[model samples]
Target: MYATFPDLLRLLFVPALAWAAYHDLRVRRVPNELWYPFAALGLALLAWEYVLVERTSLFLVRAAVSLLVIPLAYLFWFVGGFGGADFKAFCVVALLYPTYPSYYLADLALPLVRTQLGVFSVTVVTNAMLASLGYPLALGLRNALAGVVSKLMFVGRPVAVRQLAAAHGSLLETPEGFSRGGLDLDALRMYLRWRGVTLGRLLAQPERYRDPATVPAETNDPGDGSVTTEPIPDPASEPAPREDADEYDDPWGAARFLDDIDSTAYGTTPRKLREGLDVITSQERVWITPGVPFIVPLFVGLLLALTAGDLLFALMRLIGLV
Candidate 1:
């Protein structure tokens, strides 16, 4: 049996999304350039479909779907729920498949389930969200089996301070308390490298560096207090205000390093760094959440959206809602 134009177009997403998922998993980044060709192809296909379609009403529905998805994707990104790459991917998907593609395997129709809405991208987003729930569930189960019974078990796992640098995640435990916005480990490593000290070295004698005034000088300094040879910005003349300064004197000794680096570049802030350092230096084990990128689930969601239709819609139907 010959495949339809829409079917061929839909198949294109399989490899494209697979590559994106792999890239996101490996580096947690997806270059904007990767989507350029796909975007162009999608626009061309949409134009071609517009010129060839006999049903004006159906064409309008497709156009509406594409229009609706753009802002929705942007909103997700704006609220920090989705990354910029994830937003671009959804936009490309909207352009490519505004409605569910009509595909078949021999005598069987693909997407065994269907929804009245028929917006393919929305289905993909929903399916991806549902699939992402598995991460927490798996974490919870693993923690349970390991005899750990804490609410945090569902979100994070404990890692030794020495291994924290190599781990891929954000710090959940902090000196102050628990934080929803976990500290960025990459930022911590960046700061450590800037200081010419290893995590182990810092933890071995945290008290030695507890007072920023007495902390050892940076290795990169020329000992003449010159900024010419400095790798990063010079540390601030005065450290950031410490809430507990009167109670405890720079417990982590990390306050002096905050102003020296660009926090935005590392996706962290001074407060997070200060608190995270206190936890890292003072404790042997810390909790960290494996920050899974959304693209992975987006890929799985796309596959399920194409093969099984909207899982949520099917669930609603099973419960006789539609």
Candidate 2:
């Protein structure tokens, strides 16, 4: 009649993951502090579960699952497929629900399906990956409706250069042709703010700054040298350029800016800035793919794993392969 401890812990994941998904969507970053309490609780649950089972076969299964899931999480992060936050999340999931938890609502059993592996965290991740497959299909449909036909349409959309500063994605098209490593827009916005000039102004007078050699450097930087959380201003609101503005022969010192800001944080380098600037100055519209954060699908996957069970496993079973 009453919910078990594990079931109660499973329910707690709803709010925790929901908040994490919301945070990741709002800003690509998730605070490390958010995982601490959940991780601690998971460890406590793990210890309790361990003591309860001791040297039983169930304990061995849990231990084996833990060993597998933790390294898999680390591997995902090491290979850059998963973010640090995602890695930590998976670790917590492994500790909290190494095996699928059983729950029921009256006569109905929660998670209508179960897999032979019974690794709950793996189910959540696999489900997340399956859910993410929908994004490309949606992008392809939208692009097709707009009369844009290209293989690239499945992964990216065209955005105007004027909107680039305010955009969320990386550029797929560049002066060097198509590049898998898209230009980082956050770094571009940071560069703009550092110069006290809007993207419109820069684009309109590209000759004045395109070379980077002639762009003027500030005598004293205005900001506290931290990346600002403020929204990038719309290019439409950009002030008109002064007619009497003097051209500088000195270099823009973009590398200096990158160095000062610890460029690794933004995933940008001087070469990338130069290439991105070339594309921006030369093109009116560029293709970009606004990457969907994995956490969004991970949240969906967690919900599905708790309800309908492993989507991949279900599909395999349906196809008579599992």
Candidate 3:
């Protein structure tokens, strides 16, 4: 565990970053607002290493890996292989867990017990051991931990998980965790007013009801709030509400849609999905093709492999029975 600290540093940071990335993706835009704090966090990690630890390799390696992962991460995001922000967060994570190879390639040059491949041997064995113990082992461990935490906290009512089943127009039965952001009517209106969407119609078809979360569910409308009665049908009832369904599928289908067709050299409109890529070369300059010399190789290439190898040695050296 002590030896795993450096890798853990990365493990802790990237998931937090990835969460932000997922939020940015949902909005179909990355917020410029978030960039500053993370940049500072990255800087702080470096500063701490220099000022406190004096291990320049830790600072330098972390910093260098962080910087290097960005472009490749972006490329993965661009190609739709991952969310833009997920790629960004994962790049940093790669630095954290060289053995995990978070966002990059394994060191092909150094294989055997000297690189990540070697370290993975331990992970495989450990996971196998866990599997052998079976589901009961994990459940027992979790229940035990939860019981301890509850005891320390002085157990109250278990927090109810609320879900708002605002499926129908009038009878919006909020699940345990559902709410309309108070009596704010504007939030509902925002969904109704969103441009290009037949939201009102979708509203008529409550089955197609989206989360109050599509946009900020806030409002200036002051009233007791609207009301009615009826459960909204499941959104799937329609001929697959084209808008909501296509939002992701459309983009993804773009690649597969063209996979069957042979494009003419004479400037045939290759379709929208095909448009994201440059058609000049058959090479994957866009989504779908795992571009050669991927970001992982360039970023954490050597370190990742070594970390893996070390894990195996650690088992042999540390975990071996005396």
Q: What lDDT tens digits, residue by residue, belong to model 2 across residues 286-305?
A: 99887667778888999999
Ranking by TM-score: 2, 1, 3
Which residue segments of model 3 deviate by more than 4 Å? 1-32, 57-62, 91-322
Candidate 3 lDDT, 85-182, residue by residue in tens: 44544444433332332222343422234422323223323332333343334434554666633221221112211101122111111222222111
lDDT of 2 at 235: 32
The C-alpha stretches of model 2 lying farther than 4 A from their native spots are 53-57, 211-252
What C-alpha lDDT values do all the predictions have?
0.73, 0.73, 0.33
Structural similarity to truth (TM-score) of each candidate = 0.81, 0.84, 0.30
Predict model 3's lDDT versus the native. Answer: 0.33
Winner by lDDT between candidate 2 and candidate 1: 2
Q: Which is better, 2 or 3, measured by TM-score?
A: 2
Give candidate 3's total backbone clashes.
21
Root-mean-square deviation per candidate: 6.2, 4.6, 18.2
| Positional deviation of residue 134's Cα in model 2 after best superposition, in angstroms | 1.2
Task: Find the candidate with the highest lDDT and give its number.
Answer: 2
